[model samples]
Target: MDEIVKQSLVKWPNVPSCTGWLLLDRRGNWRMRDEAAQASGAAGVAIRHEALLGFINRNYEVDERGQWFFQNGPQRVYVELGYTPWVVRLSVDVDSALALHDQGGGGFEPAAVFVDEDGGILFADRAQPARIAVLHDHDLEIFSDHATLADHDGSLSGEFHWNAQLALPLQGIRRDDVAARFGFVASPAALA
Candidate 1:
């Protein structure tokens, strides 16, 4: 959390939280959901300012209820997730490593990785502070080179093919079960 945001909490401690106004899209973009956008059921407007994006990223946090939010000064603007809490990207510095760049900030340590029926790769740490996350689509190809990937039934193409000889104890699970199984809410109950 940023010092300024921390100070705001102390200065105006009772500012009610704001929800349905901010969203972290699957592609790792911060979106602002306005009244019109919400009514129209759109993905809302994209927030393109670098400074504000950095500020939100710096102050992003999750409450005890597992609701991720951006502490915009004093107001807790809960974010609606497009995938999991964090979006893992392929590290620019490394050739075969993944980087977590989402509400939880940088770096990821996925104990297990699996592909959803829709081809989205899911990572679950299952530790004390477990993270049920999705690897960014753009970097999926690079990840295929890892010897532990699971692509049985020969459904995958190119480097993502199933190689029982190099499998890594992979398992299958549903995306909707992520919150309940991992104890986090993707979309929390509306605030009164």
Candidate 2:
């Protein structure tokens, strides 16, 4: 977090949180959602300002409830996630090892990799399974490289075997169960 943002919080402590006003799109773009755009179920306008993007990234954090938000000075602008909490892209450093660059602006190596029945690739942290991310569809080749088809009863599912200790379940886990199983509420608006 930025020091200026911290000081702003101390100086003006009562700013109400703003939800449904900002969104992090599936392609890792920052968007500003207005009332009209939200009501019409339209995707918000993408924010292209580099400075603002940097500021948001610097102040971004997840609450105890797993709701990620950008602290805009005194106000907390809750982000509407298009997918998982972290949206990742394939990293540039492909020679050393396959890597992922999280939209949150960091890189990490997953302890295990999992592929859902629908071909969604999920990366699980060694320490925290809840800290998972679905790989963007743009990088489907990576998914192909890491996963193999498995027979779960009669249902065929893609299974990723990265290591011995981290094994994805034999049966396919449904998309609806993902949020609950991973300890995150996909739509925080429903809670409000």
Candidate 3:
């Protein structure tokens, strides 16, 4: 949390939370959902301002109920998730080693990999498995190059080669069951 945001919260502790106004899309884009977009059930406009994006990322947090929100100084602006809470992309570090980074530029080590029925790849945080992130679609080809899939007794199994030294087993997951299995709310607006 930002120090300025904390001070604002203490100064105005009764600000009501706003929902259905902001969204985090599957491709890691932060969208602004205005009344027109909300009424028509659209994805809204993607926010491209760099500084504003940074501020939102810095204030992003989750409540005990697994509802993700951004503290905009005083008011809590609840985020409507298009998929998983985190949208991750694969990148090569200075050592030319594979690394995982979220949309907000925060890095996390992947402990487990899951392939959904829709062919989407997701990574579970090594330090906190409950933190699931969907791999950015553009990185699918790179991910496929480092992954191996096999069939065993009519079921699918695989392994993601992190490098010459390590491989993590990949599991199968159903798209619809992701929220319940991983403990996150995809649509906080519906709950609200």
User: lDDT: which candidate is best?
Assistant: 3
Estimate the TM-score for candidate 2.
Answer: 0.84
Overlapping backbone residue pairs in candidate 2 total 0
Query: Which residue pairs collide in model 3, if any?
Result: none
**Ranking of all candidate structures by their TM-score, best first:** 3, 2, 1
Off by over 4 Å in 2: 92-96, 150-171
Q: Candidate 3, which ten residues in sequence have the lowest lDDT sum?
A: 149-158
The candidate with the higher lDDT, 1 or 3, is 3
lDDT string for model 1 (1-192, tens) is: 999889999999999887788888887788998999767867898999888988988888788988988899989999888877777775444443334454336666556666566777776664578877777788776666553453568433222222223234455666777777777767753532
- Candidate 1, residue 13: the lDDT equals 94
- The 10 consecutive residues of candidate 2 with the worst lDDT sum are 162-171
Q: Score each candidate by Cα lDDT.
A: 0.71, 0.73, 0.90
TM-score of each model, in listed order: 0.82, 0.84, 0.94
Using TM-score as the measure, name the better of candidate 1 and candidate 2: 2
- What's model 3's lDDT at 70? 96
